[model samples]
Structures are given as structure tokens and as C-alpha cells.
Target: MAGDPPTTPSSTQTGVPNNGNNPSPSEDPNNGNSPSSTDFASLPSATATGDINSTDKGLDGGAVAGVAVGCLIAGLIIGAIVMWLVFRAKGSRYTRRRRRSEDRGRLMHSTRDANLVALESSRKPMKLENFILQPAPDKEIISDLSRLDDIIRQHVETVYHFEPVDVKVTALAHSLTAIGYSERLSGLQVEDVATWCLQTETRCGALRHVLSHVLFSSIDWNSPGALTLLPQPAIGFLNSIRPIGEYRNNFDVMSFAWTRWRTLSALFLHPSPQERTPLEVSEDDIQGQVETLAKALDPVLRYFVAPDEESQHQQHDHLRVMIMETAKLGYTLFSHTSDWKFIYRDDSGKRCPVLCIGLEKLCGSDGYRLVSPQRIVEPRVMS
Candidate 1:
């Protein structure tokens, strides 16, 4: 029975038929059936179903955006902290520099010579009450005086508004040109010039020097014989009776002395002297001479005074009264030479070389350092 041709299992016993070349119902491509287990096993993974039904939508867009925003916020916080630290460091440095400057200022004041303080304090303005006002030399004179005063006020305001480093070098070049030094001022940096001009003492000195140059410009300083700083008519009068060589040596000294003492007197004295000596010149004569000279010098004064008329008139009347008062004080000094000493001396009772020096030479020095050229507004009287 075991040798009865080893009967093959029927199709009912096995799921597949015994024919080796034939395909099963599941394996028939044209039958429209699913793959059999063998076909599925032949693929990459037998247990893996095609994509499982998942509720997770990977990486929500909102979450990605939130993470990016968080990163941006962190970056902003770091940047702000960095900026704050940088500014704080700069503030600390600025504080240290300020403290150093304060210390230096204290040292400077402590080491200053006592004479400088006394010298600064001794400069007193003449009281208008001391002298009676002479008649207006001329209506024209008053107008010119007003214009001059306006120019000074305008310059003060302009420079006040200008930043030290920011001020143009050319801003002062016209003034330099007025004094015939514009070329010399070439190539100078604006910052250096502005810093020098911005100093109160230096600014005042420069202005006074310019005034002196303009007022006494008619005088011939380059003459070979005794160099007289006095303008023509007064020069003729002072040289009319030539004093001894001692007085001759001091002619320039006296001229500078008289200039600082009486700025307006330069305008008051005629280019040619009258029959009367300075000692005999009456108040009425002085007033007449001042009016005449004022008419004559108007053109020259106008050029320097209002180089830029537009700017000068911009700020009107702020310092006009004060300037007028100073001008009045100057006019009072126009009386006979008998009222004021013609000799120049330092506070130490010695002759000041500065009085003998040219105004140009003196201009090179710090105005506060020179004692002879009194300021236009306030002349320093010896105590």
C-alpha cells in the first residue's frame, strides 16, 4: 500500500494545484486579485502594510513659525543687551574724561599767577555819567556807529550758533581779508581756527585788534624817520613841535597809549591839525572834528564793519545799547589831552614794550596776555 505510486495530494488538500508551471488564483495577473503571500514576501518587508492611517500631520506650520519667532526674539534681546553695554561703556569713558578736565581746570586756577587775577579785575569800564554827552557829531555818525555796533552783535551771535569744529574756516577769512591777512590764513584747518576764535578771551582780543587796525589804519607805521602811529593831522600836530629824542623814542608808545585810551578820538582828530594844540582843543572843536572824520572814514569803516551786511542785520538791537554805551565812553575820551595821560605804562610802573610794537605784532599774541591794547568796550586803567 505504501508503494501504490505515492499518490499526490488532491487540489482540495493543498491550496495550490499540483501542476508546477501553473499560477494560483491569487497570482494570476489578469484575474484582478490581490498578491499572494509568496509575492508579498518577495518584496522588501512582509509585515509592512502600505502607509498606516496616521492622525499626526508632521511638524505643524504654526509650530515652525513659533520657533522661528522665538529665535528672532532671542536675537533681538541679545542685540539690545550688546547695544546697552556699548553705550554704557561710552558713558563711563565720557565721565572719566569730564572728571579729568575738571581736575585740570582746578589745577590751572590754583597755579595761576595772582597778578593775572588782579590785572583782569582792574579792567573797569568808564561811567557814562562822568562825561556830558556832546551833540551828535552828525546824524551820519550815529548811523555808522549803529551799523558798527550791529556788525559786532551779529558776529557774536553767528559764532555763538556755530559749532567749534563745524564752523567754516572761511567764516573768518573775510575779516582776515579786511586786515590784509587772508592769504596768511590760507591752509589753516577750520577746527584749529575755530577753536582759537571760540575762546572768549581770544575772540575779544581778535575783535579789539581788528578795531585798532581799522581805526588807526591812516597812520603811516612804515615811515623811515621816527615811526609815528598817529594818523595824519594829529601826526603833524604831535610832530609839529618835535620833542626831545626821549619823547621821539616814545612817540609810538604815546600813540598806542592814546589809541587804547581814546578809540573814537582817532576819528575825532582831523587829518590836519588846527591852529590849537591838543591842549587847547575845545570840546566843541573835538566834536566838530569827530563829525568831520566820521564822514570821511565812513567808506573804509563800512567795508570792514559790514562785510556781510545781510548777516550783520539778522540779529538786531540785542547788544546795541551796550555797544552804544561803550562808544559813548570812547567819545568822552576825545576831550583835550589834558584830561588823559598820553604816556603808556604797565601796572608794574615800567614802560610796556607792547605800546612800541606794531598792532600786527601784538595781534600775534594772546589778547589777554597783552596789557597795552585795552579792549574796545573796557579800557584797563592802572590801579
Candidate 2:
């Protein structure tokens, strides 16, 4: 021990003695031999298998995300297609509903028109004797006469196809005759009679203008049969009337006769002459003529009923119907003159007013008063 280098125990000598089964330090588990083999096994291979596994996992995640995105897009496309189909279906249904509504409205209107024609055809003419009477008060008699006149007008309009210009003229003529009879019996100067005549003359002049314009414009003057049909009353009437540019006095005798002739000829020539195709009038045109004629007639009718309590109510109702009809036809009520005032006392005894032809007012205590014609009282004479 003294001579030897301090023999620190060799790792093999210091340790407990190794059994035969136990290996030396060079082969021990703690030595580099087994540990190197274990570490070599534990460490990653040159092939980098963990990195390959990580790359595979990343690829799998990307595929799943792509599938999710694709599903979302496909769902959106499907939803859009469904919405489009739904809206298109709704539009078609709405269109069909609108078409049905329009068709139903047209059918309803046609049915109503046909019913009106049937009713009008079945109605009888009104008798004038029921309303007009002699030896009555001026107010009562005028009211009755107005009612009779309106009934007659309505009857004529219903029965006749053409404008009832003659009917108004005839009614006016009867009223003039009645007034003349009243004047002789009562010795009362009903100045309203002269006013009525003047107004009627003005209306007749306007009606003549309208008729002449329509007839002349529509007639085929150059047709082969135009000259030969001299016996036809329409042609004769047109020839009798004054030309467009020439000035004629109101209430011309020829114009009155032509009005009557035109009415009769229209009645006789229902459906119109086949050769007179150019003169074929539309229903709208005829309706316009009727509306104009009604406008001319309204003032006269209002004048007669303006003084009566009972007839005023009836007049108002009739006027309302006329107004509604005129509105439907797109026409305005016009008067020949504007100075006359139709006055009626209200529930509060206040006067309601409407315009007429002269400054003459239809208001009085007895519901009857004389209306002076504008021409009758000269300004110089009055001054």
C-alpha cells in the first residue's frame, strides 16, 4: 500500500464486487455503452419522424377547414336559390290576382251598363198634365211646371239616342204659352217669361253651334250619295243652318226647325246609315253632347223651381245626380249668363246663392216674383 501509487480504488475495485452475471464498468448500465444505445433510441431519427407527423396533422386541419368553408358557401348558394324561388312564386301569384281583379271589375261594369239599358227601355213616358195646372199661384204653378219639364226631359233623354235639344225648346214653348195664358187671366206682368225666352234662345244658339260642328265635321260631304240624299232631314237641316263664319241672331227660326229635324232624323236613323261611316259617332261623343245639353237646361229648370219649397228639395236631388254624372263624364256645368242669382233661405233663414243669367234674384216672401230681362230695362231709360 506504501509503495504503490495511492491506489484509489479503481471504479471496479471500489464498488461492491460484481457478480459473474454483472458486467464490468465498461459494460455497466451507467457507462456509455448501454446509455448511448438508449439515447440513440430515444433521440429523433435522421428522417425527422416527429416533424413528419406534425406536418400530417397540419394538413388534416387544413382539409377540415376547407370542407367547412365549402359547406358554408354551398349553404349560402342554396339559401339564395330558395329565396329567389319563393319570391318568384309570390310575384306570379300576385300578378294572377291582379289580372283576376281587373277582369272582375270589367265584368261588373258591363253588367251594370246592360241592366241600365234594359231599365231605360222598359220605362214609359211621363204625362205633363199631372204637374202643370191653370188657376194656381205663380210660385206653385212654376214649381209644378218645372217638375213636369224635368220628367219630360229625363224621359226624352232615356228614349232618344240623339241630343234632346227639341225637347227643351218644346218645353220652353209650352211654358211661354202657359205664361201668356196666365198673363191674360191674371193681368200680372210676369217679366220672367221674357227672361226665360231670352235664355232659351241663347241655349238654342249654343246647341246649334255644337250640332253644326259635329255634323259638318263628321259628314262625308264629298261622298257620291251626299248630293243625292237631299230628302234626308239631317242633310236638309245642315244645309238650312248658317255657315260657321256668318253671324246669325239668336233664336233663328231655321235653327229651331233644324233642331227638331235633327232629332227626328236621328230617331229614324238609329245605327246610322251604312254609307255614312264617316259620320259614325262614338258613345263618348254622344255623352258629351248630352252633358252640354243638360248644362244648358239646368238654369231653366232651376229658375222654375227656385221659388218653391217642395220642388227645391227635388231639384237639389236631381241636380246632385246630374253633377255626379257630369263629373263621371269629365265636364263642368256652364251657364249662358252669370248675373242671375238663385237664392234660397236655409234653416237659419240665411240665403244660399247660385249664379244664373241676370241680376234678377229668385228670392221673395211669397216664393214668387217677376224676373226682369236684362234687355228689357235700358240703362238710359232707368237713369
Candidate 3:
């Protein structure tokens, strides 16, 4: 449109002529300029051609570069949004998992609290049906030793009554050797361990003192009817209480103290199944038991009994009557501390008296139950 017009339509051929391969126009003298042309046949046989390529690509380089940059930007933006969504979902899942764990912990605590409250609300005073026999070691031997009958009745009862706490037999037994009594262990050692250490009365320390308690309560050494009498505690409780008339004006107080103590002691000792019953107890043993009981009771009985022998028949009769009353009172005092939980039995599966604090309060027919240490029995004497 400016200086030179565009070329017109022209016939073009890519092959060589059949005459021969034509030479370049500059190399041939006859091949001159093409200022004018009328027909294709009159044109020079050897004509040079300019390299020109035709294309329909109207899009500019700047436009194509822009398209490529835009495509690259779109891909990165989509990738970032997808990655953010994935990370957000994962974070939300972790938060839900953490919250679930905390909720489970809270639920468990709530359940435990509810159970404890229910148990406390259902607690009640124990009866015979709720009793169980699971005393601590101290109480175990205390009740067992009482079954020895005559050994305790004739002397130990005369002084210590049946109070194992007062006798401290195990402690007393241990003390025998400590008091300088080098007696080898033997069957007779129980009775003679104290006497062997007579020479070192001061060396006895707590040993002789414990022995003194046992001498009257275990060996029954203080009994007027005892076959063997040994060195007794110089300051025994019985010694202090035995003073008569003016010396023992306040002795009546001891009776009250003793009765209350015995009642308290009954709480710790439960009657087991007949088979599970720890010690074999019988009637002859009862007499010894009675005598042992009488030691503490006699002091009170003297308060009612006539001292003069002239009324001996009447006194004997009165004592016989009072003795029955005393036994009944003691039995009543002890029996109340427990109740019948099941049918009396001695075997493993038989009904037994269980401790009231645990499942002992429940019927054995129900199921096995756990023991509770918190459910304590009051066994100490109240002021």
C-alpha cells in the first residue's frame, strides 16, 4: 500500500526442467532483467526465487506470552486453595479427636462420683444378718485364747479377766527371753518363762510387766486354785483394784469401766460359720470362761454379796442367782454386737457371719462382694 504493490498471482513449480538443470540467473549471460512479462512461456527458464513463507498466525508474541503467564498463575492459585482446604480439614479432625478424649474423661469421673454417692446413701446400722468374721490379728488371738478354758480361767481370769489387751500374751511371750530368762523354747516355757527371770526383776523392763499381765490373765497364776503360781507383776491392775474397804472405796467405778470395755470388745469378734468358727469351744470350757468372766464380775458382786459366812447358805444362793444374771447380761452385751446374716455353718460354702462394713451386710445368696476398710467398728470404751 505504500511504496511497492504486492505481487500478483504467479505459477510456481518445485521440480527441475526436463531440458536440464537451469543455472542461476546471475551466472547466465542471457538471463537478463524481467522488467515486463506477457506470458509464462516467454519468461526466463532460470529464475531465482526469494524465500517467503505464508502463515495464518495473526496472534502477536506479546499476546501468546501473556496467555502462558495467565495459565501458570491460574494453576498456582487453584493448587494453593486445594492445599489450604485439605490442611483445614485435617486440623478440624484433630480438634474433634482431642475434644472427644476430654469428654470421655469427664464422663468416667461422673460415673465414679455417682457410684460413691449411692453407696453412702444406702449405709445403715449393722444387725446379726450383716455380721462377718474378719477381725484383725490382735482380735483373732484374743478370742482364740479364751477357748483354752482352764488354763486361763483358774488364774488369768482371776487377775486379767479375759482381756487379751491387758494380758499382752504375745508381747509377754516375747518378753520372756528378753528378761534374762535363757530358757530354750519348750512346751513348759509358757508357764515358767517369767519365773526363770526372777533374779533380774529390774532387768525385766517391759517384759516382766507384760508377763505380770499374762501371769494373771494367761497363766492364771494369781488364782487361789491354781496348781502353779509364779512371780506376778508388782504393780498389776488387779493388785491396785484388790484393796478392800477404805483402800478400794472407788473400786465400784472399775466395774462400770470393765463392763463397758467388755461390751466394746464384743464388736470386733464375729461368730463365724460353725465350721469356719476359729476355735472349738465347749461347756467345760464354759465354766472356765465363766470363771474368767467372774474375775471382773466378782468385784461388782461383792458390792451386793454378804461378806459374813454365817449367812453362807443364803449367800451361796444369792451368788448362784446373781451368777446367772451376770452371764445373761454378758451374753446379751456380746450378742448385740453382731446379727445373723445367714444359716449357721462351718464349711466354706455355708452361711457365715461376715463383717458389717463390706458385702457382709448383703445376703451371701446374692453374690461375692468387696471388703471396705473405711467401714470401721467402734471397739474402744467410750468415756
Against the true structure, whose lDDT is highest?
1
Residue 7 error, candidate 3, Å: 49
* Candidate 3, residue 50: lDDT: 20
lDDT of 1: 0.39
**Which model, 1 or 3, shows the larger lDDT?**
1
Which structure is stronger by TM-score: 2 or 3?
A: 3
Please provide TM-scores, in order, for all candidate models, with all chains considered together. 0.24, 0.26, 0.29
Tell me how many clashing residue pairs each candidate has. 1, 2, 17
lDDT of 1 by residue, 198-296 (tens): 544455333333333233222222221232223335546555654423566566555444433333344345333332222222344344434443444
Pairwise lDDT winner, candidates 2 and 3: 2
Candidate 3 lDDT tens digits, 1-383: 68888976542233444343555443454656533344355454433222122223356689899999999999999999999999999999999999999999988886666543332234763333233222224243334223322232222223221111223334544544433222221113533433322223322222222222222222221121221121122124345565322436554444333333322334333244422222222334245444443353343223223346644445444333333333332233232222212111112332221111010221111122224222212111101
Residue 292, candidate 1: Cα error in Å is 14
Highest-scoring model, TM-score: 3
- Computed on alpha carbons, the lDDT of every model, listed in order, comes to 0.39, 0.37, 0.34
**Model 1 TM-score on a 0 to 1 scale:** 0.24
Q: Per-residue lDDT tens digits of candidate 2, residues 35-64?
A: 566577867674598888788776577788
Tell me model 2's lDDT, rounded to 2 decimals.
Answer: 0.37
